[model samples]
Target: AKVYYHDFVVQATKVKRLCTTHNTITVNGQFPGPTLEVNDGDTLVVNVVNKARYNVTIHWHGVRQVRSGWADGPEFVTQCPIRPGGSYTYRFTIQGQVGTLWWHAHSSWLRATVYGALVIRPKEGTSYPFPKPKRETPILLGEWWDANPIDVVREATRTGGAPNVSDAYTINGQPGDLYNCSSKDTVIVPIDSGETHLLRVINAALNQELFFTVANHRFTVVGADASYLKPFTTSVIMLGPGQTTDVLISGDQPPARYYMAAEPYQSAQGAPFDNTTTTAILEYKSAPCPAKGISSKPVMPTLPAFNDTATVTAFIQSFRSPNKVDVPTDIDENLFITVGLGLFNCPKNFGSSRCQGPNGTRFTASMNNVSFVLPSNVSILQAYKQGVPGVFTTDFPANPPVQFDYTGNVSRSLWQPVPGTKVYKLKYGSRVQIVLQGTNIQTAENHPIHIHGYDFYILATGFGNFNPQKDTAKFNLVDPPMRNTVGVSVNGWAVIRFVADNPGAWLMHCHLDVHITWGLAVVFLVENGVGELQSLQPPPADLPPC
Candidate 1:
């Protein structure tokens, strides 16, 4: 209904955390950046000036950019990154989506510091599906590293090893009073007694899935990834790196300060992670104030163990659509894709300091046994539109190249994956079903798969393997949850279905940054329909160069 214009400056700033200072790249110099609030049916025009040292591109994490691929920024996927000292503009409109989404740097590890919230409310004449809350708050969960995040990834790339984990988890940008030198700036959420508040929680960590909760408070989940769901009450919820959750909470407890904290949800066995927690305080204004300069300690919540798979599975399976809708009753494309970690044997003459992993092999990841490699010469969408040859191939396998016991013991010979820039081609408006099966190549682990450009309904999830004969009967067609991301449990399977109505080159990949860097990704190219609007718009004049 309206147009929102903004200017973002990507520049370096001195940021202090955990008693150490580092020069970090940020958007407009804000730690978590500025929150951009817009209503449904509104257009956003953002002019981004890259004043930082490295190249930059901003991706609207969960926004459905309809036919506007030029504005859907994903480094080399849709467009090239804006180089240092250059500028670019992103323009798109919000069609029917309304809830919590976010924006972040899509290049390298810059998103660790350059990220913020993008909230979409209902259109002019529409309202929320559930009752309105007294007020709303955006709670962003992030990770804090003692060293520069870019350096961490650079060292990992140089050595062909996994990146180092962060020093502490974060609520917004602070490590909160639980850590040293953070009590003065701890984030405090003030609320009135007996009033309900809406909390939009986003997990922006680079490589971890987090479990978030508030002390002595249980919230009612209403939406996720911008889609409303059947209101369910839960004590805690889990979020992958690229996921968002919207919940309603009431201030029914005694008026005092209670801790809202987040910790790692580590389902992958033997994977290294940060064991520390981040927190904020929910301060009830109706309670008596604490003595000056001598405040009482906030009450902390009890969270599940780091490897609590049962609790995570139960919470994930509880999501359902608030209303009945037509699921893909008939399928057009059924794909059984195997995704997990693998190993790449180090070259005999390699002389890097960290070149060794397990048994003299470097770490790798894959889908269909193909490691995804991004093109540095041109963007995928650009090459597809200009009919350029040799940039990429549309022969990404429809199924795993070789299939065995997906969740059982895998041989060492089959642990190596080939790297390529490949995409799967599809017709517009085709119904699709993808069975995302987790494997035990290195170790059975939980992977949250995120698909860009479309939201799909989650039909069913089960452990071990997904058998069509037995599992197909368990699909929930009546009220399956629609979401942009789903966490396939460790050694488990999840089935999702969506219509290929958007014509563009879109990416489907694991949300963990480390896994993506190791080649756990694929792309889909949907052909255009017989209409102008069904086709992607021409490339913008200010599109960045490769």
Candidate 2:
């Protein structure tokens, strides 16, 4: 197959709707970015030019770069930031993936405006487990803040506490009607009567899981996180941050425009984040009428409350222990880590001991007591130069002796780089398992943890602590969704297992960009094996410079 190439300029654009004007960042001046369609074996070359004021880099989320780690995007990890007015070309081949993935900015806050859908069609003559829909649409969910997002983070870091919530949640960049006194708040999904539409939904929110539903309609979810699952029908679908779902909506019923909407699924007892942010609207257009008329407000559906624990638990269970296919068990490696929220005092000065926190509070989230520290430079490439050993630590905590210490004095200090750290080493085809425990120290914030290069199975999850005897009995050693990311419940714990079949250095981090910026990130060192996969070939000479 021939290689495909595209050039895009990221810039700001003005959009007018419902008598209101707003500014948005776009790729090549198009909102929701552009779509990239390719086959399984096709090569993709994208030249991303940063025309915006801030630095930027683009990541092919969920696409395993494999040995092409140079193309992996995570500023200061695989590559450096593309400075303002600078350009970088991401080159990689779409190897074994065939489903719905996405692309987004990797630099700080730039993703707020730079993102798009990446659709990989199956190889010739290949088909999915379920029937394909006649029409398909990508519904990218995002967060919107009228104030500058950078400023929001800046203030939070200075205050040493949680940042203020966003002004609204957006579906395809529109905060469908739900906000008060907002005239331009609406999401319009045009659909023909009696036809089915495939809605590809991506929850790109920084800090919240979402519950989505449409008025007077049930959807059959057939795919998730770029992988096809056996189709299942439901009235509402719950998706965590960084997760994606593909559902088919039947337009056979009364087809006047009906509002499709999404809202935060976090409970009131959790962190103090926004509760009533409406992300998008599904507008079902009816068959043509004789004359044009104003579209009456679609009847608003009764949405579930923000803190409905039963609904949340039931929704989560629906996606658990999937029944359709079985994954091979000749696994490769296993690992364990605990996730929790705490506080560490940042020195009043850069390297001084004298420190203070927000209202004298020092709060943060981490995996283990050791918060991940993102290197100032791309550590993977540096490791490759320095012999790949001694760059990362293999001493990650195996298990937390105290799993749920709500009153424990969790460390409130940031991750300061140790002068020397032992690097993690793993051979190809290693089966990996990571046990994540969430401790309720200072605040109980839910963390959506994500890993790069490969997806894993959620073996088990439980609340209020991990007991060796009692917890092991409830393990669902069945067909959990093979996911690249999973949520660590507030004041609870989760155990995920996978195979490190892809050979390359991979990143694992909190999906919340805010926590990621605060140093919640790590790298996996997949050592080269004997035979065909022993070593990786360097990138091409003309590889776009990021």
Candidate 3:
């Protein structure tokens, strides 16, 4: 194992797209930023210098910091933001995780441009479980906005409504030739006639789940969220924000150009979203440019309809562990948490003038009816570590206080969710199972819930409310797929289990930027065990203070 050093200069650089130019905050002046390749047991020491105007902090999206919570970044969850002109170094070792993960700004609206790929290859002298590919490429799917993203979220925050949808979807930070003024910057990938390649596809789009496909090529699913899968072939796959999928693609097509395209897989009815496609080109090696400047039409794959819930469910359920998975079958803690949007009534005498939600109410979301509000002065981790009071409470409900038909109509009185900085306490090394139940309060939507610091086994997923008596029988305990994130289907539920082995505060939330802003989140405070190895390491001397 070795230490890797990187200087992440978060500075503003002018980026032009869609016939408009804006000063976008990026790492090291690269739009998609630099890819960090490291071995499984390597340590990463990334010094993030905040040269941008906004307070910033970078989160290693799927890296389990283990007992080193001081390096787990999530604006005000694990640590305070590095103020403008300030700097902080994230130092942590990637213990057992190996595969494609990513790093991004955990602060408000800033991840719109501040992000990069964190690739974890196998440990030194170790080989991949599958055959080595001829080459590997990182395909980062994203969203693009013509306006300042900060302003877009600010307006939504003030009005209590949905934020403005992005202007276009992006593949490797380019909108491809589908949009005007973008053809010149389309990303191109070259491949030999019959070689195989590994595509590390990541969904970094702020608010939408994307469907990705390649013209005249099929993908064999090999891994996801850094965990190896059973390797099944498919034509299309969907990825929610913060999720990564590893697929092997063969260059078995004719010697021609093909378009790799991505669009949204929005399941929420009445939801506003970008309906455009982003693409990149896959050209045969040494393929010449079209003669006489007349370009041939690139072949485009048939993506699923924007609202195809069945397709999304089928793709998600197709994942399976290649071998026996270690799941905590005898759960120590069982919790049922409901997640969805809710509406808060306008204040008395306000007459709905300031509210912009359903029936003139403010929009919000929650887990177990508690809307997670972050502490401003210090992070939950810092407060818990130093015994600081009034920062957060550890009484986050283990189950919904009231029971009802989660996927059906509920009483209007249950529409408002209480907001607080609440966390669930867990004993280190305890096995736990959480039934993430999605509701139809405001509208049923697929919420990609990402849990930091641990990869959990997705035991089972099905539509409508979960019935332990029925669903328990359908659990795939032997070969459940492991992941750091799982998309809770619309009007449905998913069961995930993990050991509370990492002591520290870990934030679990919806990866959709808009849903997170509406308070769809929770924190888990796992108490330290007896020895230093099981407890959090001492805070670094240079740890940023609030």
Off by over 4 Å in 3: 267-275, 286-294, 349-353
Tell me the tens digit of each residue's lDDT in model 1 across 1-546.
Answer: 999999999999999888888898988889999999999999999999999989899999888889987888888999999999999999999988989999999888888999999999999888998888999998999988888888988888777777888887889898887787777778888788999999999999888899999999998999999888999999999899989999999999998888898888874422222236688889888768842322977777888887888898889889999999889888898888888999887776876465656776778889888899999978999999998899898888888877788778888777688889989998999999999999877654578999989999999998988888999998999999998988887688999999998989898999888888888899899889878978888889999987
TM-score of each: 0.97, 0.87, 0.97
lDDT of 3 by residue, 1-546 (tens): 999999999999999999988999999999999999999999999999999999999999999998888888997888889998899999999988878999999999899998889999999999889899999999999988999898999988888777888988899999988788988888888788789999999999998888899999999999999888999999999999999999999989887788899877764422222337888888877456542221767776787887888887789889999999777878899999999888877788765555887778888989999999999989898899999999998899999989989888878777579999999999999999999999887764589999999999999999888998999998999999999999998789999999999999999999998989989999999999999888999988877889
lDDT tens digits by residue: candidate 2, 388-460:
5644567655543334353244443322222222235567767776777666555445677888877777777
Q: Rank by lDDT, descending?
A: 3, 1, 2
Q: What is the C-alpha lDDT of each candidate?
A: 0.87, 0.68, 0.89
Q: Which model, 2 or 3, shows the larger lDDT? A: 3
Q: Which residue pairs clash within candidate 3?
A: none
lDDT of model 1, residue 535: 83
Distance from true location, Cα of 503 in model 3, Å: 0.4
Residue 319 displacement (Å), model 2: 2.6
Q: Give the local distance difference test score of model 3.
A: 0.89
